[model samples]
Target: MPTVSDFVIRRIREWGVSRVFGFPGDGIGEFDGALGKAQRDEDGLDYVRPTHEEICALMATAHAKFTGEVGVCIATSSPGGFHMLNGLYDAKMDNQPVVAIVGQQGLNALGTSNQQASHLERTFSDVAVYVQTVLSPEQAQAVVDTAFRTARIKLGPAVIILPHDVQGMEFSPLTPENWVSRSSAVAPSTAICPPEDDIKRAASIINAGKKVTFLVGHGANGATDEVLEAAKKAGAGIITALRGKQVVPADVPFHSQQLGLLGSLPSYNQMKDCDTLVMLGTNYPYGQFLPKSGQARAIQVDLKPEQMGLRYPTELNLWGDVKTTLDALIPHLEAKTDLAWQDKVANEMVEWENEMEAQATLTFDDGVNPRRVFFELNKRLPATAIVTADAGTTADWYGHHIRLQRGMLGDLSGRLATMLAAMPYATSAKFAHSERPVICTIGDGAFQMLGMNELITVKKYMKQWQNPQLIIVVLHNNDLEQVSWEMRTEDANPVWSTSQDVESIDYAGWAELLGFTGIRVRTDDEVPAAWDRAFATQGVTLIDAYTSRNVPPLPPHITLEFAENTGEALLKHDPHTVEVIKDTAKAVVTEGVERVKGKLHIGDDDKRES
Candidate 1:
């Protein structure tokens, strides 16, 4: 008879799970054994072991994000489960469907202070939509089914705990009885649309306004055509949340790139100036960047009703799938002839792009400008490339400089947890789409935290990819750049060198040791060629670009509070204060010059060629 562990593996495969990310331990030894047996039996499931449980979990989340499949991760009891929390939270907060199969102490050992035992259900309660422990072999299938179902429906992580002994038990199917519930692997359709009345009401609100702005998030992904059509008809400018970057390409005329701190100036201005706000598939968290309450009438469309009005005071809420809802609502919208607002927003976007180039090319004495690295990569990025970024100044440069063309995909930890999911995300993305090239941008602090370990995971699996063009770009700034800026701007305090400074590491040297091509970049001129060599290399490559720590990751719109707080911190005579001030002044001056040139049409003939 097949063991319960065997049945669990077979069932997930039947549910279309071809890959599982995990780290093995004695607690899951039986399952690991079963995995080996399945592999011998030519089972299609590919089990991948990362260096740590946290990385495995992050890989699972990335798999779901990249492939649009339910990502599954497995880990042992206690410490293994604890390590999976951060990645699980990343999935939960970002609303990705992930199922975590964790080991637990045997039923007999429960509450007995057994070694490696933990109350996993209680621990996972906050991050998972469903948490269940299978007590018997007959219960395993149903639990697995329910876990996957809940994860898919809720769009979050789900947990299934299997006691050590349960894995060894003889598999038994649930009987047709009232107490023993049986479930199928088939997922229900999610094509939903709002009622006709609600659609008309939303249309009326949008039709009433002179200046309309559409704020889109990750949920609007597949509805790009509908969104663009609706925006064109309504003469509205589109602004994306970072997660929604791929939904509408930045090259689109009326699409303002991104919103909030990592967003663009045109997006910030559009939100503040619009008379009407239409939110689609995104619950963008930064309310301050949005129109003030009562300043603009809002209409929100979300698959989840609960997420609709939480961020903004909306006059109308449409509970439906983004594509379907927009498809239904588009016909009801009246076409706008006067596109002055749209034209204005588009022109601002052109100016913003010019300013971005100026910022990227700004000279820094300490190291190469980080923005220049991303700006160069942006020019070289293939349309099919999948990009991942870690949380830090790396994300800032990525957000401002990297423009996703059609067919390209990109994402990070949307909640910005700073656990450094970029490496794992890129790893899983390459696994999901073996034929596509992948790129990851990370800061030194995050790279030191967990990215280095994940590189080994990449080294182990590089040959498995059809296209082994994985580029890991490390922003080798010898400082915890983002946090230092936050301390200065948010806390009005000087840099705490002891806590913020990061020890330098030869990331490229480390990659070379792992049998991967490594390029060390220290100057602006070397940045473009480094990208070129990485892209040209047929195997995995790492670009260790030394960037200036003093170069500020300026926001789209600098407010009074931010300016004042930064001024206060500088007044305290922080270490590197002179460098910070000089870098900042240069950036601001560049922006001003770019703006003047844009307005006067002075530099159009002399624009830098790509």
Candidate 2:
């Protein structure tokens, strides 16, 4: 005899899930009860409590992104369920193996309606691989199997909606047959590599180019090593999307700077100069930064065939999982270029870095030294340390800085930049490894946008992390960092942040109050010391480094929806930005439609947008 809760928990363990990142509530009683008993059991796993459910999902997204395993997160009904949506959208957008478990009020309580009652399943259906509600123990087991399958086959995040009453209910001895998921039911292949000729043709282009450049994206995470080697053979330069930056080592000579809005100015400048531009593992959409097909040969290799040439036109298209294609291409390619090319790209990369830090407005000349903090921490951190960044200007900065050491960043992913995604994503990243130190780089303004509270998961799930510590170094540029700068550059009044009462709500104090080892870092020296204490002393730590919020507005900066002054009379904001964003978005959307017409990435995803 077993219970739905037992089956779900057991299923979680079977999938190698040792840590679960989430926030629970009164609505999830029976499920939580099972969680308690399981934890008490000899084999029970860890429930990772995050500062917020949204953070939990994003954390789960990162954990999944890096490991290719199903990253799991949980949250309660109503707003909590809604809270997880933002990060799930990120996971789905980036195709990470993420699974979100949501607690429900009661199946019977539907519309007959209890407090906090809301449409949880309907809310998440489109964003998830599959959205389901459990009714019986049989359905519970089925959902568990579905959860595993959804994560693996769908290639994105999935939501398993659980009814509280069914969680711990007594059930008859269920045979193992129903528990083992059928592979066909979970994962269905949606795309394929181009024909044999396509691969050879692309490989030929790679072997021919004297100066080849790679614009790597999130899709290219695990294949960095292979891509680097290929670059070595071609004497090429490799650049990555901000999210994909960590995959390549900072010290790699061929590792180039990133491209797009908020990327290195030099790389953006190099777009027109390269002889051949290669797009790998990334579906970077900014056309302004992409290489021009007429000027440079553009080649694309991606996991999905349709991904090639969606934004930038491609001269040669090769479709295969990055690792697989690299294996095949290495044998096909001949040594074409010399080490001098990688050296030149590497030099340009260094110059770009110096210029970035020098001109950056985000530096703490007043008192805080963000550049120093990031540089020093990056130096001391094991090339292996995983960094989760919240979307804001800091993401752009972190994008510009913080390259991982060799092989350490093989698992990290996600570039659909959004804020507060870092807190929980790091919470999940650290939790996934438990002992692995996961650091979150975020801005104070961005943190206020979401899950600034899931820190409790630190104390609640202490036993899971051998150290159970999360080190969050907040780059607090007191002004509405991006907006204020936008105003200054354009000569308009900055809409300074009303995000939080910063004086009243000191984040370091909140971390301290939450049983964390909070350290306020007002100067540069304290940044490393705080990190040392955080790593050595244990528990969670918050290093509040008050930085200047003068960083450049990350490009693709919002299409100003409202009246915003841009120097001359407060005329309607720049229409060009909106038009570019719309055009970029449409190119992607149009590509999808064309693919659906030709049977591309859509599978059994039944959620209808129309």
TM-score versus the correct structure, for each prediction: 0.97, 0.79
Q: Candidate 1: lDDT of 525?
A: 93
- Most TM-score-accurate candidate: 1
For residue 344, give model 2's deviation from the true position in Å.
3.0
Candidate 1 lDDT over residue span 393-439, tens digit each = 88888889989988999999987454589989999999999999999
* Candidate 2 TM-score to native: 0.79
Judging by lDDT against the true structure, name the best candidate: 1
Model 2, 365-475: lDDT tens digits are: 455656656766665675457777666566655665576776555232344667667766676666556667778887786666664666665566656677565678888
